[model samples]
Target chain A: MSEMLAHLSLGFGVALTLKNVALCFVGCLVGTLIGVLPGVGPVATIAMLLPITFGLDPVGALIMLAGIYYGAQYGGSTTAILVNIPGEATAVVTTLDGHQMAKQGRAGVALGTAAIGSFVAGCAATLIIAALGAPLTRLALLFGPAEYFSLMVMGLCFAVVLARGSILKAFCMIMLGLLLSTVGTDLETGQERMTFGFPPLSDGIDFAVLAMGVFGFAEVLRNLENPEARDVVKSKIGRLLPDWNDLKQSAAPCLRGTLIGGTLGILPGNGAVLGPFASYTLEKKIAKDPSRFGKGAIEGVAGPESANNAGAQTAFIPLLTLGIPPNAVMALMVGAMTIHGIIPGPQVMTKNPDLFWGMIASMWIGNLMLLIINLPLVGVWVKLLQVPYRLMFPAILIFCSIGIYSVNNQPVDVAFTALFGLFGYLLIKLGFEPAPMLLGFVLGKLMEEKLRQALIISRGSFMTFIERPISAGLLLVAVAILVIALLPSMSKKRDEVFTE
Target chain B: MSLNKIEAAQGWRVRSTQDLAAGLFMIALAGLALFLSRDLSTGTLRQIGPGMLPKAFAVICAGLGALLAFNSLRYNGEKLSGWSWRGVIFVLGAAVVFGLTIRGFEIGPLKVPQLGMLVSGPLVVIISGLAATDVKIKELLIFAAAMTIGCALLFKYALGLPIPLAPWLLGI
Candidate 1:
């Protein structure tokens, strides 16, 4: 404990440096702005800034990028509240009561609740990172390839339950995502799988291309299609702060969400996005007046917003401890770190204590900065919404194109972005959730590689997955979840819980 | 905003578009996966063929495509309809144009000789501008030219990416 405290003090010493603080501030501010914009998501922003980070120290660059990630989480709720648009997948739950509250003349309270809840969650998650990150890393390293494959299978099971539509639809989306991930070269044999003899595709699909196309460009398409459909319902901002009653009602949910999110955030794949959705669903189920949900409930906003931020902050655990990235944003951060010659692994803590501590410390400071910046700037952000879509969308288009192009400085990536955008928009229109698709896309490559490696290690023994304790446990959980979800009673409950 | 109104708003036209789009994409993906799965020559258990995992995934994708088509066909329920093909085309078209001009045309400020920034930059802007709801000639030209020049300066001079400035002038 004394050593941990000393290390934390050392971390503060580095994070408090003038240059690092400045970068952290810039990242948080820019992250907030980018998050507020519907199309300019955190992943794209980080990828766009990747080239720029090559010039900075790895620690400082990471601190800034980390700030941007959590800052985007904070800012995402602001849009979800003021307008009914969720800037990121995690913020989808925020829109349930956030925009509803705004329509009900409680925008201020919704914004305030979200801002405060997120701050608390961020702080809580940072503490978890400081306390548990090392131990978690040790445990995570115990997970072999077979274990990881099983864990991902379990994660998919959780995703199917949490996804908005039918379980079959979600399963279909996941399968589709996995297939897309297989499009690149096969790593074990250096053989091309689905490249179709296209040299550009031999390297595989880039995350930036997939994200920009699905989340950014597809969103633009959706907006343009229904310009009037989403007529900004006139909302008068009220109660610049959360009322006592609001805070009283939200405290318990906020704490619960923080804990849930922090734990899930450490899981690989898109568990960060799943945190808020799960929290919202949980909160609603436990609420006395469930009907108040989606009709302007403060618990709905506070719980999910807190969960979203906590998840965003704790998500750094995997990146810091293992070389594995839990999400795309962290993957880009890994790329940033790799470019700076700082290889991330379990040794990151011991080898570069300053970088580890400084990053953790910066998350606390960055959250503080977000709270200070976001609350006062709510009006300013709302004003941004007034900008005609005609003008704003073109800028979004330019950024998306430029960002995708820079991935390899190759035009082929840009083409993929367009193709994926069409694919994404079509999915959205078809009642298919792209979140599962994306999760599958991100996990697909890793799953394939790990499965192949496990086979290689075990010499084609299918029992290898069951032989490993961790793998066995994870597979058991996957089986349990599938069984529970398939049960008639549980399926009815799930339908009621989601569609309601 | 009422539940009935929301449900009424989503109709068959929107559902059909979604079905067709998702179905087509799935079919194409399924075809690709199946094509990739073939001709796998595995040597030994220790050294698994690269195509093995991908082929398995392809079969899974084909199964998913069939399932998606089946779902759409059986129960076309509670669809999120509101088709926006115009928006889709505009964004897609812009991305394609960006790729073609940069890679295929090799058109940039530095390579264009005397008319580099003046011509290539404006073209980039104009193409991006085409995605907007209304195409204003003056505003499009001004924004396009400015954006093109800015991008050229940022990418070419500042970052120093190896972007070709001219296609016709510097033929080796």
Candidate 2:
């Protein structure tokens, strides 16, 4: 405990620096602006801003990016409450009761509860990281090739379960992603497997290019498809503070959300996306009148909001400790760290304690900053929502084209992104979720490497995975999840959960 | 008579065209991948080579695709939505044009000179702007101009990127 304090104090010393604080503030501000805009998400925003961070020190860049992540979460709720549009997938559940509250002239209370709940969750999750981060890193260090491979398998299975719509469709998407990831020259042999003799593809597709296309450009296409679907609330702004009754009702849900989110966020493959949905379901089940959930229950807004923010923070744990990214945002972080010649993993805490601890400290400070920015700026955000999709989409297109072109000074990358944008749109049209594909893409190379390594070590025996206790346990869990998903009764329940 | 007529309906037996198309697409992609990677050596498990994983992924994708295609026949799903040709063509066209113009293109004996960041930036913005249903000519032109300048200043001057600002023909 003393050592932990010492480390935290050191972290504070680094994060409290004027330069770092300014970076964090700027990141949060920009993050909120983009987050408030429907169809613009952190994945694309971070990818666009990646080049800007090339100029900063690793610690400063990461701190700023982390600020943008959580800030976007806070800002997404603002849009959900005011415009009935979710700026990000994590904010989807927020729209249920949040929009209703806006209709009931309780927009101010909904926004306030979200901000306060997020702040509380952020602070709690930050402490959780500070306390458990090192131990988690130690645990990660014990994982071998087989264990790592099994863990990724489990992660992919979880992704399939959590995805909306048919499990088979999601599985197909994951397989496609894995195939895409296999493009480029093989590491073992000097042979190119799927590049089709293309020179640029010899090094593989860029993550930023894929993300910008799928999340940014494809989203623009989706929004443009149905112009009338987006409706901004024009009602008068109400009081911004929650009443004592509101606070009393929200306290327990907020705590429960934070706990649930903090635990799930540690899992790989975008586990954070599951937190808010799960929390909302839990809140509805436990409530005296469940029907009030979609009708603007305070608990609905409070629980999911807290879960979203807490999950955002704790999702960083895997990236920081194990050098493994649980989601697309963390994958981008891995790319950012790589640009600075720093490989994230167990060694980061020991080698660069300041960077690790400083980032954790900045998360808390960033949350405080978000709370300040979100409350007073709610009106400004609401006004920004009035910006029509027509103008908004063009700007997004220009930025995406420019950002992608800037990556390698190659126009081919931009062209590839455009192609992926169309592909993403097609997937969405087909009721296939893109999130699992992203997870598969990010983990593909590592999973392949680990699988090969484990196989080689075991002399071609597939039983190597089962021979190891940790690997065996993880595989069992994955198998169990698949079984449960396939069960007739469970499949019906899953459909209900997703449809709700 | 109503029951017999309802049961005899035989148009679009696959229930969801979207799912059927998605499944067929996946299957085709998997087949292509397998065919392309057939030449690569799939080393044994102890010495797994590049082709091994690709082949494995192709098999899995094919299997999943088949399952999805089968499922589409049994389950009712969402209908395929109308395509926005304007949005698709203009947005994708803008990107392709920017790519070709920024660096220029050459096909056999023909050559197109690079237009640099200034020309390409506005070219992209204006072309993509045409996709919008409520495009205002004056507003769009102004936005295009502003965006080009802003991009030049931010990317080239401020960020120190080496994007060219003008064509060699301009002698800038």
Candidate 3:
């Protein structure tokens, strides 16, 4: 405990520096501004701002990115409440009661509850990350090549099972992503696998280019097809702070939400996406009158919002400790870390202590800043929301063009991003979720390396995975998850859960 | 919906055109990957060469894709939606133009000079903005200008990223 305290205080020392604080503030502000826009989500907001972080120190860059993530989630809830459009899928639950509350002239209360609930949830999850980071890193250090490979397999399986839509399709996306990851020159042999004579393809595909293309440009293309729908609340936002009654109603649900969301987030896959939905269901089931759920129940907004925020924060645990990204957002984080030339894993904690701990400490400050800035700026955000998508999307396009162009100063990247943008649109229309693919892409190289190493160590015996206890355990879990997800009865249950 | 029914009446058992297309696409993708890696050696499991993982992943992907395709025939699934050609053309056209003009590309007789971000930025904004069916030209042009200036100040000046800001003019 004392060692942990010492580590945390050192983290505080690094994070509280004026420069880091300022960067965190700016990141949160920009993240919220972008995320408040109707179609932009946390992923797109982070992808757009990714290039800007290249100029900062590693610790500051990560801190800013973390701020952007949580801030985007907060902003997503705000959009859900006022505009009746969830900024992302996770915010879909928020829109159910949040928009209804706006219709009932309780938008301020709903927004307030979301903000406070998120702040409370964020603080708790930050502590969880800090407390768990060291021990998990210690445990991760014990993993061998076989174990690491199995762990990644488990992570991929978790992603497949947890993913929305057909599990078979999700598995296909993951394989495609792995295949795409193999396109560049081979690491050992220097043999080009699938570059097709393109020079840029030799270096493998750039992460930023792929992300900006799929999430940013493809998103603009998708949104352009849909008709503009801006039902911004025209009435005055009465009060920014929740009254005592609202607070009393929200307190327990918020606590419950944080606990559940934090737990789910620790899993290897993108379990965090399910956090808000699960919390909402729990709140509804246990409510004094379950009928109040869709009718702007304060608990409804409070629980789901808290769960969403907490889940976003705790999702960092796997990334920070084990170098495994549980979801696409964390996959983006891995890309960011790689750009800074810092390989993520236990080594990150030991070698770059300041970057690791500072990020954790900064998360708390980021949450506090969110609470400080958001309550007063609700009206300004609303005013920004009225800015039409016609205007907004063009700016997004120009910005992405510049951002992609800035990376490597290659015009080919811009063209490639355009190609991927179309590809992404096709993927979306084909009922394939791209999140698993992104995860697979990020982990592919590492997985391949580990598989080879393990195979070599065991002298071509595939039983190395089975002989190793940890590897065997992880593979067992992966198999169990895939089996459960494929079960006919269980498929119905999953569909029922997702219908919300 | 009516078109789907007609297709069904035509005695084609294909249920989801979307799935069928995706399956065919994946198979093609897998075939291409395999063809490309055919020259490389897939070394034994011990000291597995570069070709091994690529082949493994591609084969698995092809298998899953085939399953998806076969299942579509067995079960009713989503129908293919028409593509937004207007949005695709203008948006992608804007991006390609940005790429070409920001740093001009030349292929034989086609000679284009570097137009720089100053021109490319607004050009992209204006061009992509036209993707929307209800785009107001005058407002879009103005937004394009303002956005370009904002991006210049933000990317070039504030962030200090060496993005070409009117290279033809400022010679930076």
Candidate 4:
């Protein structure tokens, strides 16, 4: 515990530096702006802003990016409360009771509860990362290539379970992503796998380009298709603070949500997305009047908001400790870290303790900054949302184009983005979820590398994966998840869980 | 027979167009991948080559695609939604124009002049703005100008990105 404190104090010393604090503040501000804008998510925002981080130190860049992430989560809830539109997938559940509360002239209370819940949850998750991160890193260091491969398999299965709509479609998307990940020249051999004679294709496609194209450009296309559902901002935002009764009711739910969110966020394949949905289900199940969930229950606002923030914070664990990104946003972080020559993994903590601890420390400071920014500035965000989609989308397009072009100063990347945008749109039309595809893309390269290494070590014996205790346990879990998903009754229940 | 009765009679055999299209696309892509990587060395299992994973992925994709296609016939599913061609064309067109303008493109037989303009940002904004249902030219023009300046200041000056600010003719 003393050693932990010593490390934390060192982290505080680094994070509290004037430049780092300023960067954190700027990241939170920009994150909130991006989050407030309907259809603009942090994945795209981070990808767009990645170029700017090139000039800064790694710690500052990551601090700002992390700030943007949680800030966006907070900003997304505001839009959900004031207007019915959810700015991101995590905010979807917020729209249910959050919008209803706005209609009842309790928008301020809803917003306050969300901010407070998020702040508390963010702090709890940060501490959890600090305490458990060292131990997790130790555990991750023991993992061989076979264990890593098995863990990724388990992660992909969890992704399928959590995906919206058809499980078969999700599997296809994951397969497609893995295919796309193989587009460049083969790493082991100089042989070109699928580059089709293009010179630029020798290097694999940029993650930033792919993310911006799919999440940024395609999202605009989807939003533009349905133009009728414009922003309907509630005119009256009552008191910003919740009453004593409201606080009393929210306290337990907030704690429970943080626990649920933090645990799930440690899983692979963007399990953070599942946090809010799970919390909402839990809240509704435990509620005496379950029907009040969608009709303006304070518990609904408090629980899911806490869960979303906690999950957002804890999702960094796998990225920081294991050097594997659990989701697209973390994939962007890996891109950022690679640019700065700081490889993520167990070695990050020992090799660069200051960078590691500084980032963890900055998260807590960022959460505090969010509380201050979100409460007094609620009106500003609401006013920002009143901007029409027609005007907003063009700016997004220009930013995306510029961001992609600036990455390599080559127009070819931008063209690739445009092609991916169309592909993403078509996938949407065909009812395939793009999120799993992204996870698959990020993991595919690493999984392939690990599998080959393990195979080489084991001398062609496939039993190597099952022979290792950890790898066997993980593969067993993956098989269990698949078996459960394939069962007819369980599959029906799974569909109901997602659709509901 | 009425349309409703025909639909009822088809029942579980009725396939969703969306699923069918998606399934076929996946299968085609897998086939293309397999064909492309067929010549690459697949080496032994102990020392697997780059092509091994691609081939493995191709097989899995094909199997999943077939399964999805089969499942479509067994369950009722959503119909494919109408495509917004105007939005699709303009938005994608804007990105293409931005790419071409940023670094001039040239083909031997059919030639479009290389105008390596830095005004790609504003050009993209204006073109994509037309994708909206209601396009106010005056508002769009103002937005385009403001965005161009904002992007120039942010990317070029502040961030020191080497994006050009004007056309070659301007001689800035």
Predicted model with the maximum DockQ: 3
lDDT of 1 by residue, B1-172 (tens): 1125555566433334455456656777777777766765554555667666666666676676666565554444554476655666666787776676655544465331322333444554566556666667787766766676676676556656555545446531
Native-referenced DockQ of model 3: 0.77
Model 4 Cα lDDT, one tens digit per residue, B42-150: 8999999888989889989999988777767765687889999988899999999999878677767755544543467778988999999999999999999898888
What candidate 2 gets wrong by more than 4 Å, as runs, is A289-291, B1-12, B167-172
lDDT of 2 by residue, A1-500 (tens): 88889989999999999999998998898788877887667776676667666667889988998888777777788888888878667888999999999999899999999999999999999999999888988898899999989988988888787777788888887888889899889988889988888898898878777877888778788777877566777776699899999999999999999998888888876788888989999999999999888999999999999999999889988888887788777877877787777888888999999999999999999999988878898888888888777777777777778778877788888889899989888888877878678778878888898999999899999999998999999999999998998888898888876666
Worst 10 residues of 3 chain B by lDDT: B1-10
Task: Give i-RMS (Å) per prediction.
Answer: 3.2, 1.2, 1.0, 1.0
Q: How much lDDT does each candidate structure score?
A: 0.73, 0.85, 0.89, 0.86
Q: Write the per-residue lDDT of candidate 3 for residues A262-355, one digit (tens) a residue.
A: 8898999898988899999999999989998899899999998999989999999999899999999999999999988889888999999988
The candidates' DockQ values read 0.41, 0.68, 0.77, 0.76
Q: List the residue pairs that clash in candidate 2.
A: none
Q: Tell me the interface RMSD of model 2, in angstroms.
A: 1.2
For TM-score, the strongest prediction is 3
Cα-based lDDT at residue A363, candidate 2: 97
lDDT preference between candidates 1 and 3, better one: 3
True contacts kept of 3: 0.82
Give the docking tier of candidate 4: medium
**Tens-digit lDDT string for candidate 4 (A359-378):** 99999999999998888998
> What local lDDT score does residue A127 receive in model 1, on the 0 to 100 scale?
85
